[model samples]
Target: MLKERLYYIDSYCKTFTTRVVKESLDNMGNWNVVLENTAFYPTGGGQPHDMGLLNGIQVTNVEEIDGEIYHTVAERLDPTGEVEGVIDWGRRFDHMQQHAGQHILTAAFVELFGFPTVSFHLGKELCSIDIDVEDVSAEQLEAAESLANEIVLRNLPIETKWVTETELDQYSLRKNVAVTDEIRLVIIPEYDYNGCGGTHPSSTGQVSAIKILSTEKQKRKVRVYFACGGRVLQQLQRKNYFLAEASQQLSAPEDSVNTAITKLLETNRTLEKALDEAREALLSFEAKDLLLNKERGIVKAVFKGRTVKELQKLARLLVAEADDVIVLLVAETEDRLQFVAARGAAVEMSMKQVSASALLAINGKGGGNDAFVQGGGERTMAGEELMNKMLVSFNLDI
Candidate 1:
């Protein structure tokens, strides 16, 4: 037997009494009860299921399977007598406003530019409709939004009616109906006429307002994001809060916040460039001092808290100053050790030999050509010990 859909009869019906025809455990082991008549709307047509209490047991989900509407509840109930079901009005009305807003906005797009809405989704806080176009301009969005709100302000009646396939020709439809039997059409008078199975408000004014938040390209179409009714107010409140916080932190008025932020970023970039130049000058002075203490045309030094890049820069500066100099530098940090080996253009020894011996002593990995090599690994051995191992491999007298 087909259950009477009380929601279709009266979308405003929040509470109803219905007899439970059957009760069983669903595939996921949840209790599902089928009622002889129900006001709860099932999840379908991009709209979510209605949720509320069914005889005090919370109805978690409602779905239609094989033409029967099953209400999934927290606990099992007797399949013998009637049960009282209540709909969450807040959620129901929010959906109504958004769904209706979509219809109005969709019609506005078609009426203004012949853009057809191919799909729609009613999300928790926002709603979207994908149009059959590659792109939509900001001006088009503004025009559509303006026209949609005008319809809402006019408060046109929203009507729904069941029609047969043969009777569908009496009025022009925005799109073809998907179902042949029990064809339901939601009409906004001479403006929008389309087949839909989701719940909506009785009139356009109930939507309160419609705002197109943004749009993005999806494949060959454009998806428009929007919010309606109470959601619009919530979005405005959230954005205002963020702007207020930014203004206070920047010590600027709301209207001048953008200018202040841009100026701050520019100042930061200038300071960073100056710091880099100063650090490079200091490294060059230190490299010259180290060259003065060289022994046997080889310079060796150990330092703390220096990066491998800095060590490489210092070694390069040392070799550039003397034609016969070879530099070996090690930097130690809390958890690791880094070293650089570089030789002047006139030096005969390959720095690769130094890196190979140093890497083996610390169980590290590094690579370079005949003149320069650098590497770092876990601080398994003391930096001085590793440097002594490399010197031995070099067969240097020092």
Candidate 2:
């Protein structure tokens, strides 16, 4: 016979005495305790299991399998005697508020718009519902949130009743029941009627309030993030802390934080653009100087702690100004080496061949067309030494 689930009979019961019928080890080697009557709710219907103490031993987890609710514990209790079962009321009530709030908010969405909730997840910090819609707007979310809070304010009674599959036709269910044998319907008078096995509070007011945190498009549906009951206050405090820190860092008042940040970002962008232009001008002058000092028709240069991008820009500038020049540059960081090889329009050298041969010195990898090639690898030698080695491989006089 199936043990009576005391949680279904009284969701508000925090403490109860139940007889331990069986004790065994699960597949994972965890101790499982089965009770004749249990107040603990198992993990089901997207809601987590209730954690509590059984005969003073901590119950870590609870799961239902084949009509049996197994309470995972660390130690075994006397199977022949009754044990005191005390659930963590705070955690249980928090989950109840979130679960009930979901019902009201979901009902509000269906009543206001035509969105149907597809899935739900009650997370540690926040809860979310996936709606069967392509998109959800801010105004729509606000309207639903307002309506849900109105229901909570009205203190509408949240009732649960057991029904069979045949009796389901008497109620307008928001979703199909998962079980046909013993279906439990959670109803909110004329507002909501849905098949649910999860425990809920006695009234909607116990949910306190509902706040829509954010929403995003997920596949063909929309996932809406929200917080109910105590979670709403927690989210508010976290956001307020962030805003306060940002305002302090920006040296702006709370009311003007947004304006101050916008102006600061604009100023930063302007400065970045000006700095980029200055850097480009400096690179052009350096390219000209290197060209003036070129040995024959080739310009070879080595730099310390320079980037591959800078080397590419310098090489491009040099080749653009002189058509008969070949540019080979190497940059050396702490333990890495980078090089770029390019030929001017009038020069007809195979840069790919030169790059392949040079890469052998440092076991590097890179690719490009004949006119321009860039690569990087481990620094086996100094930047000047690597550059000389590349010139020798290219068979060019430096």
Leading candidate by TM-score? 2
lDDT of 2 by residue, 107-180 (tens): 99999998999999999999999999998888999999999999999999999988879999999998888886
Q: List the residue pairs that clash in candidate 2.
A: none
Structure candidate 1, residue pairs in collision:
none
Listing every candidate in turn, what is its Cα RMSD in Å to the true structure after a full C-alpha superposition? 5.5, 3.2
How do the predictions measure up, each by TM-score? 0.74, 0.86
Tens-digit lDDT string for candidate 1 (1-398): 22148988888999999889988996888999889899999999888999999988899999999999999999998777779999999999998899999999999999999999999999988899999999889999999999999999999999998888999999889889899878889999989998988889999999999999999999999999999999999999998999999999999999999999999999999999999999999999998899889999899998899899999899888988887999999988888988999999999999898898888877788878889999988898888877887788789857
Quantify how close model 2 is to the true structure by its C-alpha RMSD in Å.
3.2
